[model samples]
Target chain A: SQQGEEDPQALSIQEGENATMNCSYKTSINNLQWYRQNSGRGLVHLILIRSNEREKHSGRLRVTLDTSKKSSSLLITASRAADTASYFCATGSYNQGGKLIFGQGTELSVKP
Target chain B: GAGVSQSPSNKVTEKGKDVELRCDPISGHTALYWYRQSLGQGLEFLIYFQGNSAPDKSGLPSDRFSAERTGGSVSTLTIQRTQQEDSAVYLCASNLEINTGELFFGEGSRLTVL
Candidate 1:
């Protein structure tokens, strides 16, 4: 069973726009991490927000976590064409051997 | 130093045949993981190995899938009697013991079952 499920199966926006994607998980987590995947390549770690933390930022990426709702969101500011990729949210449980269970992911397309 | 590396960037095998995928973790990394991703789908956890202790094989879908890590560095995932459903990109990742939760992924091996 997948622990997390991301909303908005697909998204499209113009360059320089802000893109927001949401993820909902089933259980409590020790931490939640977001990753970006380009076509025919591996995933790249973007940012990680601990359960105790409500929000985190890395460059243009902003992530917020709401443990009460079991949901998280990743926001990309000033999006570019290169930001066009599939974004996934993964949850790591404190008791689950630190394994990350990934969500279905959201495909974002930024057209220049 | 290099990050995780997976051999045979691409592979094509007939259905019912066996295939072996290898992963070379970053030097000194103690935690290694394997995942499978289908086209336009999220990554699915397969198995995990930490040091010389027992591996966490709970994520393996069936008995046909098996993995082994030698000396806690190099790992191999073998799939027997491969089926079309097995076609996907197999990814390997590794992280230092202190931060086992942060994974550095490899380019991945794209497997295509005919």
Candidate 2:
């Protein structure tokens, strides 16, 4: 079963614009992490936000987690063509015992 | 290796045949995971190995799918009597330990079942 569900299955924006993607999950999570996949092959870890923390930022990426809503959002400021890829949100829960359940993912395209 | 490594980047086999895929995680990492991703689909959890403890095989779809991690360093995923539905990219990832955060993934092995 899928724990996380990402909104806006696909997004397209011009370079330099801000792109936002949202993910909602069920059950209590110990932490939530975002990953980027290019060419549908290897995935790179982007950022991780623990349940105790509300927001975290790394470079142009900003992540916010709202446990009350069971949702998380990823905001990419100053998007670039290189950022075009599939963004996935994975939730790690104690009940799962260290396993991370991934979402359907949001395909983002940054037009140059 | 500096990162996770998977063998036979691509594989093609006929239906009812068996295939094996291998994964070598980064040195010193104690946790390894296998996931399946269909074309244009999200990753589906397959199996997980943590140190020398028994693996969590709950995510495996059926008895035909099995994975083994040798010496807690290298892992192999074997599928018996493959079907067309089994065609997808098999991704291998490894982390430091339980809830340690961040998983380093390999380039993935693309499987095609004819």
Candidate 3:
């Protein structure tokens, strides 16, 4: 079953603009991961944020986790056309033996 | 393999037919997974195998879906008595361990039932 729900089912933004996507999950998670899928193909791992971490950054990508709210958000700064893809948030808990429950995903289109 | 590899990138078959999808995870990766994606349902986990032993198969929707891994390296997902609704992309992924977070995915097998 899917545990995460990503807001803004679809998003469109101009190149160099910022893109932000939010995810809310139901149960407690040991960690959360963000993945990007291009052309409905294989998913690429972007980043992983543990339950103890509040925020993390990698390059232009920034992810914030609010365990208190059972929510997380991904922010992309200076987005480019290549950044366009479907993003998914996966929630992982130790109780599940490390299996991840994924969200439906948020489709982002960056127009150049 | 440098990354997860899935065979029969595309499969087309009639209803009631059986289809087999193969997945080769990165060498030494003990964790493997199968997921299904369709128009109606999003990405859904079907099974998870850890070194030839599946500890989690609760995500499998029905008895028609089954999977196995051998030598802790390669895995196969078999769908029996396939229905039109079974048409979807079957994805394979792997990681170093079941407890690890990083998952490497394959290109996925696109199944079309006609």
Per lDDT, the best of the predicted structures is 2
- Model 1 stretches with alpha carbons more than 4 Å out: none
Summarize candidate 2's per-residue lDDT along B40-93 as a digit string, tens digits: 888999989998564578889999999988898999999999999999999999
Ranking of candidates on lDDT, top first:
2, 3, 1
Chain A TM-score (model 1): 0.97
Candidate 1 docks at the CAPRI level of: medium
- Where is model 1 chain B poorest over a 10-residue stretch in terms of lDDT? B94-103
lDDT: worst 10-residue window of model 2 chain A: A92-101
lDDT score, candidate 3, position A50:
98
Per-model TM-score of chain B: 0.94, 0.96, 0.95
What TM-score goes with each of the models?
0.97, 0.98, 0.98
Per-residue lDDT for B44-91 in model 1, tens only?
999888875534688898999999999989999999999999999999
Which pairs in model 3 have colliding backbones?
none
Error of 2 at A98 (Å): 1.4
Q: Which tens-of-lDDT digit does each residue in A1-112 have in candidate 1?
A: 8999999989999999999999999998999999999998888999989999999999999999999999999999999999999999999986777588999999999999
**B2 Cα displacement, candidate 1 (Å):** 1.1
lDDT of 3 by residue, B57-78 (tens): 9988899988988888889999
lDDT on C-alpha atoms for all candidate structures? 0.91, 0.94, 0.91
